[model samples]
Target chain A: MSIDKLSGLRVLCVEDDPDIRAIAELALGDVGGFDVKLCASGAEALSVVDDFQPELVLLDVMMPGMDGPETLRALRAYESLQSTPVIFMTARLQPDEIKEYLALGAIDVIPKPFDPMTLGEQIGGILDRHSGTTGYR
Target chain B: MSVNDVQASLVALRSKFSGRAREEILFLSRQAEKMSEGKLTGAELSEAYHVLHRLAGSAGTFGLPDLGEAARVLEKSLKPHVERLAATGVADDAIAPVEPLFLRGIEGLFGLVTDQPASVPDSQNKTVEGVDDDSHGTQVRILVCHQSADVRLSLVQGLARYGFQCLEVSLTSPDLAGVIAESSRVASVFVVGEQQLEGVASECRSQNVGGRQLPVLCLAGHDSFEKRYWAAEAGAEGFFSEPLDFPRLADSIERLVSERRYRLSGRVLIVEDDSDLAEHYRLVLESSGVEVRLVSDTRHLMQDLAEFQPDIVLMDVNLAGRSGITLARLIRFEPRWLSLPIIYLSSEDDPESQLVAMSEGADEFLSKPITDDYLVRSVLHRCHRARQLSELMNRDSLTGLLKHALVKQQVHKELASCRRLGYRSCVAMVDLDHFKQVNDTWGHGCGDRVIKALANLLKNRLRETDVIGRYGGEEFVVVLPGCDVGQAQSVIEGIGRSFSELLFFGNDEDSFSVTLSAGIAALNDFSDGDVALEAADQALYQRKSAGRNGVSVYTVPE
Candidate 1:
């Protein structure tokens, strides 16, 4: 896969904490060099997913209203986003909990307190591996 | 955007987050109070849980790990309560039992937030400018002399991991002595093959770096008592037989470098009320480069301890009007001075009195009319042991850096000194980039090596007076006294660059390198050490956001 596969990629970040949301924007947009959009909550993400048509969605698992899995399900309801890769960013990464996230069709889970410096590369690697098998557009 | 702009934005965002977190904690406290008063319904309980859940998830990401962990514990504890309230409807009894628990959790969480040094608004004007470039000249250099090029290259590469820049010189060079003398200004340690040890040791013994003998480490092909004896006779401080254990060699080199960096003299506080005797003891200790403070009045013992911060105390059993045993007991009452070594001085050699002095927190009892040599030896040994014990207790075993609490205390102390002397100081938050990936990919052992390598780098590169601490796993807090933010940025940037170049070997031939990102904040800019450290952390996040392997100085956004 090309290294630039992640560059200029349209990514949506959904986090309730404004500080974390801003940091994610910088990580994905500035450091990762990806086209990024940030949404405060699952509701905000749902409202923007169709129009933005992001290539990837980075969802926070424990949001206040309409959490990550619920938001993923809601986004999957949109016909266009059914096969779109969604990565869950979470703090809780117990084995069983990770299984639950994967069962919900999340491409992978990037644990919280992530290295903002390499967030984009991490997402890119995950996408590269998943696309090899699933071949999602 | 420029890296500086991004860094500034990140700092602003962090302070904003701190402010918002404070408000959120306040709100949570109020909700807890409401629950205690039976005024909270199911909605409030759920809202409180969400607040805690948010804190648990986000606090660590913002560099508040303690807060995040505390919030996580409280959130986990409150999960069942929230679920029960949601499932059973508004039952007052269901919430009653959790009221106290919820309140205590809120208080603990609030303490974490408020413990952040209140941000001082006007201190921004005092940010120091014009940081001299020469101040960043403390990088450790090692001179390597070996017969084989392969051995030289391997040694250089291995030493580089410990942040030493190795200058390789051919062992057959006729000007070996001249090279040693010329490199004395830069090179701290000399490493040579066992075959070349005699020549290198003779040359290194004559060369000194900063008034100390250059340490020599010999790499031998085989281990033997004769070779060891030969190396020792030739003045080699360390002998490592191949295959070389780089970590062990690095540890020895680090210890030697630090010892050469600063040879701190012992400090003794004498509580002898006898004017003549106290003066005599002070003169005797001072002759051996030991700092001595004599207190004629026992009434000022506590004040003296606070001000002097002595390594050891010498108390005469008989004071002018008070008992020295009582004074020793008083010193032991304060937990901070409990580790201090106290020796009683008494003319009477009664075994019972000596036992009594030992019982009242005295470490040793010395009979009066002792020779000056005996006093110096006893006091110096006690002082050295006390310092070593204190360092062991206050240091992280893995990195040999100050533990988290001690680092924070050092920052506070530095800030106080900066404020008093009107000098600049900087607190830097340094974290290894993608450290978790290192652990997951190459096992915990390799990860530990990486952390240790970084610690060695920081210890070797920074000034001797700088206080370095392992704040958390793969996170370090460095307090740079008399350094402005700009100076710290350059120093830390150098470290970050060297750290990225270091390769850690995993199973098989897999080698990976990790980078570091550091954020620095001027101590004068923040109200207290915690706020200053937070600012530094915010700057660190900024560096991470702008890409890793760099340093960013925190600038207050206009």
Candidate 2:
């Protein structure tokens, strides 16, 4: 189950909370096995995305200065990051939230307080399903 | 220590260390279990999920490790169920056993903490959702049922901020429409909630609120996708969801407000053959803040337009033996006003003819019996755009008055007709007494204000059509169309008095007004406007040497 699912997977995590970032990084790295980069806010994520060239972005829905949806919209316009897999992790998503997020080109939504052990595996499954037959190489 | 004091202190220690946490945990556990049983519906499950998420966060903050762990588990279990229900529209009854597991865990921690254990009732109790009696007073005439109280309050506050007199009621009531009907002047109804659409619709119909339609906005709840879809079908106007995207909601409100359109403040020149219809247009347009000037004959059309420089032209399509469209084409051919927005206010219902009229240079082709909103919208849409262009052409930068060319073209025909009728019209030439001395003493800014102040004084005192123009430099001219020599002198005398009394500019210790020397001359013997104007100038020169702050009338008798 040690899928290099995100090994050199180039994942960027835009979360405000250090604890949440620690939780996400630990979950994504320890479980998902991706090269996860963490930024504190949407603004920082926008600034640093050029240096990272992240293939998959785990974006927090609510963050100070720019927020998640605004960042995603700005990110969509960039030629380099247009095809990146974006998964929204939000504490506030009602059941109907998935459709709106998916419509905005998010690969999937991960509800918060995600299982630290299976975070990478779940993201790997989603990437695998979307990339089609890649099977988390 | 006394025996009673020792016992009380020990009890206090037990309560502080253990009892409160245990009681709180047990109370929450029982409440959670009861809600989770058969009592909570799919929608309530969504609410319970949100409540538990907050509880879990708080429990971690309070160091209630076991209670936090149980809350976390409950939150996790509810998420998938809510999501699955949203996707498949099916609720799994199998998740019922997970409720007891969480309750047992929280209760076990409660037993360890407190001396007095809080008892958990095993039997299920029914929880009624959205059935709380509205504690909000009847003063809240218009009830808004947003999912959260803060959002509803913010919207209410915003509306109140903009001077929209309204009321806000509680969201806990199931019968939202019934609460809305209680207002005497429910000028509009806005329902913004995601519950009981049928009940809301019936209440709207049963109220029989005439003319003013209640605007209904349903804010979609998590489990109410069908309600969001069928809400407007149930007679609601706007459908939104939480976090309640205010800009989108505001746009919808703007449309509703536009539907009940605002009064248009504009000027319209109506050209019609029928005197009654012309008068009717005048009354309608004037009541809606439109300064209307009607010309019943085609002969007076150019004069009216030149004088009024109206924002929009409302012409009757069928004029005296000619179509209004032909007249509009003729107007469009003029280089000075090639882009005038002419609207044909006609009874013709044919779309092809309407198109033909528009092609003939009419901006709008409005049908007769136009609604107040349609009329206001049409006039405002055309006029507001035209005003931007006219501002450049009409404005005089120096004195902030209408330009000489524009004002002359306006007052010329009025002067001609008034002269012909033996209406005892008078022309006065007013010169600011020693104006160069003023410019030299007070600088140009003060001089400008003095000139502006005099113009304002004359405009404020005299009738609107009594034409006053800056006849170059400190000299001004006023054409009194219906005034004889005696009346003109009195009018100019009053102006001279008011002009000398006005406060111009003050520099700390001193403030002073400007004075004017004017000469008045009636056009009794003279027939031409230019010759009458020249005679008035000679009289003004005599008044200047005869000492300033006085009026002199021109007379041939010597």
Candidate 3:
């Protein structure tokens, strides 16, 4: 992962579990070489998205307070993030289950027990497909 | 199963498995089992625990020395596993050692069991077999996160051979929850190994990754009943003793897919006098795979019945002057539609009206202030039942076309506005010239033949966008939307000429033909509908006076 790919990229990660959060940060930040910020709740993600000014967001579908899909909904309220590529990370989803999330405008979903090494790559691939270019290099 | 039975079993299991790590293990094991059984996270696990805890204490009191001693050992062992998993974000490797021992203990108890229900032992039977249908095969999505990319690919390739859509999530860097959550987007099942069970479940639960409720078939390397039970507690819906029983796992997935398919896809029928309500109903239902139809007026009950064939006729009971009960009664009286579900929707709350509506054959009645959820459920229930009825009755009333019941439906569209924003609606009444003479001269048969010919001619001459309705004998009403007097006159005149050109023959009489006189009227948007009809009727009379073969435009007397 190069800084050029991640140079101006900003990402908001919403996850309630710390171990999962840490691994996501490492993958999207160091391994993927992207700028990433983390929030644990849907409400928090909504409030911080503008401040973080992220180009992309990796949201976890389930959270203690506000889950991933709800966070995505809040993300949609911001005109800037409305069209921003969002990839949902969930363990309990099936391709069919993603229909509602996709209808809500998520670019893709990444299953749980994710591989730390390729987490960035998978997200980058989805972003690339949706925006015609990946913010990550 | 009864809560008490579950409790007793848990108690017996707890007492049989007590150890230093017993508490966490028992809790985790029971929870994982429940999860694997398809219970969503936030499911109450305490009941199961209360039973086990009670059993552990009671076993000692009952003086079944071996049972008491065994339970103590199990309980003591269960607690530490929970601690280790929560602290380390992974299931403890310690569970592996107890696999054979736990199974042996369970079997030993089963062997000694006296009078326990046989059904209780078959708890594992609840697991759903996934996506059945072998000849064509199915694409089962698998989420795999392991240390090696090779391992992931190998699993993927293997699953692909079985026609599965294999999605690989690597676990090397941790964040197992994120990976599992992401997997939900692609795979139907997440196969987490024993080592990653605790972390995966917690993370998944947080993400609501299937609420940790969807099937996450665990593959354990060892036959560890303790670990299996632990995996179930963590929200895995199914578990496989490892070496991966691919066939059985596939079967489980098949069952899960079927279960999900059977989940409700609501059906709704919106009987709305308001076009906007009808449109809203269409929007909500179509998106959710609901079949919807709209009937603005209750007068055309039979027409609506024959066409729409809605699972539930969602009626705007108080449509204009007609009561919904009248229409419901009309439907219920018919043998074909007697049991048809009719849901009366109204703003009126008179108990008398509700009772009348119910008596009139409405299966369910809802008030106007209905939530989207309630509307959805009511329609779903009714429509589901309606679908079980035979297929002949689905048709539409206004145009005498097949109703939304038979065809896919779109919202009742409002007219595309014209510049005159006011009631500038055009009404054309085409009546026969000396229609009584034709009836007397050619016997009623000639008159009937001529009327049919005129109907056909008017239909052909008018613009396809126009609303044409048969208005009694020899007279047809046509609504030309967005049309002024000029457009209406021209269309009506053309139909008049076509009616004259129509050649008709009676059963035993000479060939004869008839001419039509049309009255066209355009009303301002604010004009009353009845006033427009009267004006149009007056103009029609004027055309009759003007030698009967042309059209006369109505001009409001200033």
For every model in order, what is the iRMS?
15.1, 27.4, 22.6
In candidate 3, what are the lDDT values of residues B1-558, reduced to their tens digit? 353544364334333333322443455455545444545133233333333333343332222223333443344334444555557765534444333333333333332122211111112211112211111123345666555455566565544433355555556645554445434543556666667666776666666611224456676667777876787787777886635544345446655754454344444446677765565555444433465566656566678768756556777787766667777777777897776677788886998868876876787678887765566566665655555343224422222323332221111121224323443447776788888988887687556556545543443344445556566566666766656687567656755664564445544245566778888777553235556656777889998887888999888777
Q: Which candidate is the best by lDDT?
A: 1
lDDT tens digits, residue span B1-558, model 1: 665565565556656767888898999999889878888877877898888877777775554555776777667656656776777775444455445655766777754552232111111111112111112235566778888888888887777656566777665667666556545544678888988888878766664422456788998998999999988998899998876767668877877876663354688998887776676666556644577888866777899889899999988888767888888888889998888889888886889867876988998888878887788788877887787787789889888899999999999999999988877888999999999998999899888888888888777666567899999999999988876676677777777776787666676466778999989999987778888888999999999999877888889878
Superior by DockQ: candidate 1 or candidate 3: 1
Worst 10 residues of 2 chain B by lDDT: B125-134
Tell me the spans in candidate 1 whose CA falls farther than 4 Å from its real position: A1-137, B1-143, B149-188, B198-215, B221-248, B259-264, B414-425, B481-487, B522-525, B542-547, B552-558
True contacts kept of each: 0.23, 0.00, 0.00
Model 2 ranges off by over 4 Å? A1-137, B1-310, B314-328, B334-339, B343-375, B384-392, B395-402, B406-415
Model 3 misplaced regions, further than 4 Å: A1-137, B1-140, B146-158, B174-178, B209-214, B222-228, B259-264, B280-291, B297-312, B321-323, B326-341, B347-356, B376-558
The alpha-carbon RMSD values of the candidates against the true structure, listed in the order shown, are 24.8, 35.2, 25.5
Candidate 3 residue lDDT tens string, A28-100? 6765667889887788788787688888888877566777777777778888876788888764455677998
lDDT of 2: 0.62
Best by DockQ: 1
lDDT by residue for model 1 over A1-137, one digit each (tens)?
34376688899899987789887887688767889999999998889987899988999998877999999999999999999899999986778998999999998898876545446656766776575421111
